[model samples]
Target: MSVTRITDVSEPLVAAFANLVPQLSSSATPPTRDEIADFLAQDGVYLFTYSNDDGAILGMLTLATFVIPTGKRAWIEDVVVDEAARGHGAGAALVEAACEYAHEIGAKTIDLTSRPSREAANRLYRRCGFVARETNVYRYGG
Candidate 1:
């Protein structure tokens, strides 16, 4: 599969949704088709697609930026590869692309969180040079 940044404004984001939804938390709300298109129209969010030679989108990743007093940071919010495409390097390619993009944007660090239940994903992150930080991530969201 080939890795590409999603840059075509006229392209349909729906093409990548099915591969993404299942990878999200079960209780999380899936974006409506319209929301996907609107999100793609914004800046500071990077979406990458892994497509086969036939142009079927097999995986996607969403990276968002945070600007705080410290500096800019990048967080990997979603990463999903079609079940049938797992053994291949689509996931890795997506992560690698994010790293390149993060560097391009002068981000101080790239962070991501995976559920404890997702052992394979944790392993992949570690293998990709991510250290298990000691800091705890807290949320006060409703």
Candidate 2:
């Protein structure tokens, strides 16, 4: 599979997001196809899709960019692979593409979060050369 940023039409990503939304959290709101398409067109967000030679999407990774006094950074968001495509390295490939994009854009670091329940995802992150870092992340939803 090959990974490329989403642009033009992104129906595949919308479908993938639909599959992932329910798994994220019970309260999480699912986005419509238009929302996914719009987000893909936004600045500083890298939405990469993994597709087979036949041009069928198997997985996707969304990297949100941040600019702070510390430096430029990338936060990986909503990485998901179709249930049937998990073991073929699609997830890793998507991450590799994101990292490469980060480096290309002069980002100093990249970060991602996984719950303790997601053991396989944590393993994949470690295998992708991501080290555990101590930091506090707080979220407030209105």
Q: Which is the leading candidate under lDDT?
A: 2
Candidate 2 similarity to native, TM-score: 0.87
- Our model 2 lands, by Cα RMSD against the true structure, at 1.9
Q: List the candidate 1 regions with Cα displacement exceeding 4 Å.
A: 9-12
lDDT of 2 by residue, 56-102 (tens): 77787889998999999999988888777788899899999999999
Q: Under the 3 Å rule for N, CA and C atoms, how many clashes does model 2 have?
A: 0
Which residue pairs come into collision in candidate 2? none
| RMSD, every candidate, angstroms | 1.9, 1.9
Residue 9 displacement in candidate 2 (angstroms): 2.2
- What do the candidate models score in CA lDDT, each in turn? 0.81, 0.84
| Candidate 2 worst ten-residue window by lDDT | 8-17
